[model samples]
Target: MMITLSLSACMLRQASLCIPGPSRTVLRGIHQSGARCSGHNRWSKIRHRKGAADSAKSTQFSKITNEIYLSLRPPASPDPALNPRLSAILAKAREVGYPKSNVDTAMNKALNPNEGAALQSITYEAVGPGGQVGMIIECLTDNSNRCVSRVKEQLNKYGGRMSPTAFLFERKGVIKLSLDPGTDRETAFDTLFEVAVEAGAEDVKVVLPTEDVHDQVGGFEVITPPSEVSTIASSISSPFKVIGVEVAYLASTPLRLPANEEDGAADELETGEGLGDVISEEVADKVFSLVEGLEDTGDVVKVWTNVAEV
Candidate 1:
């Protein structure tokens, strides 16, 4: 009698296993004849990486599309020139390479709601693991029940739970004004402060560009009462462009991670450097993950957190 075995194509592609012939039975133990199939391994890695990239792109596109739809609703104009919010969103869509087709579709849907379920805006509040951190999540969705369930799932997944976190924040309007190229930072700040104050802005401060690779220029962030957002934006003089305006829930008292003995002293020393508040690297990462997870849910439009800094 003779015994033989054959490896499947898929198994062979993962690892090259060999067994000696009968004559060399003593050395019959299975051996890896070669390293893992490089071609197969490489392709697998490429596929996974591409999948992740595609997922991120899809999420971004969805968020942008929702924003476009919201901007086209009543009280907001479909014409970009007359609607600052819509204008800003369109600019952002272009910057992000959101397909024109999607934009057109969202606009059509907003213009003709009878063709689909009406979208609703909902806000959910949550507290972090230790109740030290609070978050405000804003969502726009056609299915409120599904949206609420998805949000709650994400919250529980990250050790968070729905709670009344609204009291921890203050609702106000934020306007981002772009500065002219080559403007002196100090002079620009002074001018912005003066003009913003005269125009009913509650506070004005320099805001650095976000993490977006395409955004290279920093600007002035103006805070105002919700009613004054439009007034202040229009009141801004030349050399500055009103890039974005939105009503947002700003944390009244931002929370910092409790400093441990090892990093506490170091954090205290750097406190005067304008770092505001400090969070442990580990906790910060979790906080960020929780926020991102919420944002990835199609309905979530914005996630506001009380965390001062990572």
Candidate 2:
């Protein structure tokens, strides 16, 4: 005699099992298979990639929101026209596709004096892996001890250590302006060069649009004295839109890295021994990881490195 047992559909679905009468053939088949289907594996990979992307976007949004709050602190006005720094931060938020609601929320928090404790700004200097790259991390937090501890932890975890790296950098104002579509690059550069110089700019260079800069066909980076940042940005005329303006700690002497082993080998050949200044790709990756980790920390607002490029 064959015995029969009935299982509810809900129970079977919850257990990811199929029961037909009293037969165990389906269970045996699944057990023999052992591994999941290819479709499931593909879906898992896609989910993981999406998770990483979402995490990056979240980090960016959080940083921008913090910036907005900081920009509205005492001595800074809620009106963009009165606060150039706030204006620049808002422009950055829009460029990154930050939601308008979030911006308004940050502003509201800033405007309320009792919303939270006053934020204090701090800067931490460190040397990255290989001791070739110097970094300056800027942060704003209500608790200095907590912020410092977190920064130190990230630095230690990523092969970096706190040290005096500030001497490697100089404070300067950086303004990035995008050229209007159909505008002649050369003409715009020439016009901006003259205008920037007249507005006390230190230097102006044309930056060709890249994958990272999708908003314009081309742009110009104007370096100025820290106090002249807003003056220069406001001085820009039509055909050029100011995209970013900030007082930044720029590397005084950028540390150049070899693009490949061949380049390093060539440098070593030129010198009697291995080039002490050049860092390997592995070390560069570690430095980049350290910077990313630092930026991900809640208090960290900006991270600058002496390394030219990665």
Candidate 3:
């Protein structure tokens, strides 16, 4: 099944990518196969057999339970758009079939003054295989050491290590305009180009890939680094439209791996689509195992990878 990342409103919730001034939520769900919304045919479900290759069903459940609690705040209108992050969290939770009672209990706790726990968002940056630059792995957590250990272990086992790689990827605030027919592509595109340039946009791309050029939901993705996120967002100065904003990870220089048909599961070496055989499935398993275990620690947050192989 597709793993949904639904959380309540208060705790750790939604995919709030950076858009200029502050972070804005893109909704709640995983991008195993990036979709426009939760209502889509999830390819990840088909990619992984039997829910998970491993039998850590119980352990995974426990971790998601914590995530739900960490996702929402107290009480809810139960709508996502009005409260995008929380709404998405609930959607993800339901998709996972988390107990209804557990969901309700979490809502109740959000309003419960006695239930006070502040979760901190943590991000880790590291260099991976092939001298490729890295990504920022952001997570919501309460501890740091636990997160660090998991990171170190994975890096050592994998073909890389961590350091101050936050600068490797330019950070920025972004607003993804998923326009409908009502929104004109030409006008919208022209407006965005103007607005983004004025806002100091480092980059922008029409996420929908097609020849017809107009049948996709993913719209123009605007990028701005951290310092300019807020400024650009405010200067855009719109009154009513929902211009979603959040800091996002953008590769400074994308690496293309070399395809080696003999080794499809390529490793650290960055190459074009088929140039390399990726890191072995076993290695991926190890990395996921360590990452998931670290996630359960509740302190370690976010993991980014340029590990071309896996």
Point to the candidate with the largest TM-score. Answer: 2
Give residue 115's lDDT in candidate 2 (0 to 100).
74
Ranking by TM-score: 2, 1, 3
Q: Could you tell me how far off, in angstroms, the CA of residue 18 lies in candidate 2 after the best superposition?
A: 75
All candidates: CA RMSD in angstroms? 22.1, 22.4, 11.7
> Global CA lDDT of candidate 3, please?
0.44
Clash count, predicted structure 3 = 62
Model 1 agreement with the true structure over 1-310: per-residue lDDT tens digits: 0001112221332122222234211222212122111111222223333343225888889888887876676776788777777777888788778888888989999989889798888999998665567899999999999999999989889888888999988999888777777877557765665667667677654544433343345566688888777667767766777777788887776555544454333233223232245555556556666776788888998888875421
lDDT of 3 by residue, 79-116 (tens): 44444335435655665666788777756654453666
Candidate 1 residue-pair clash tally:
0
Error of 2 at 304 (Å): 0.5
- Screening candidate 2 with a backbone cut-off below 3 angstroms (N, C-alpha, C), the clashing residue pairs are none
lDDT of 1 at 154: 90
lDDT of each: 0.64, 0.64, 0.44
Q: After aligning candidate 3 to the native by TM-score, how far in Å is the CA of 300 from where it should be? A: 5.2
Error of 1 at 276 (Å): 9.2
The estimated TM-scores of all candidates read 0.72, 0.73, 0.49
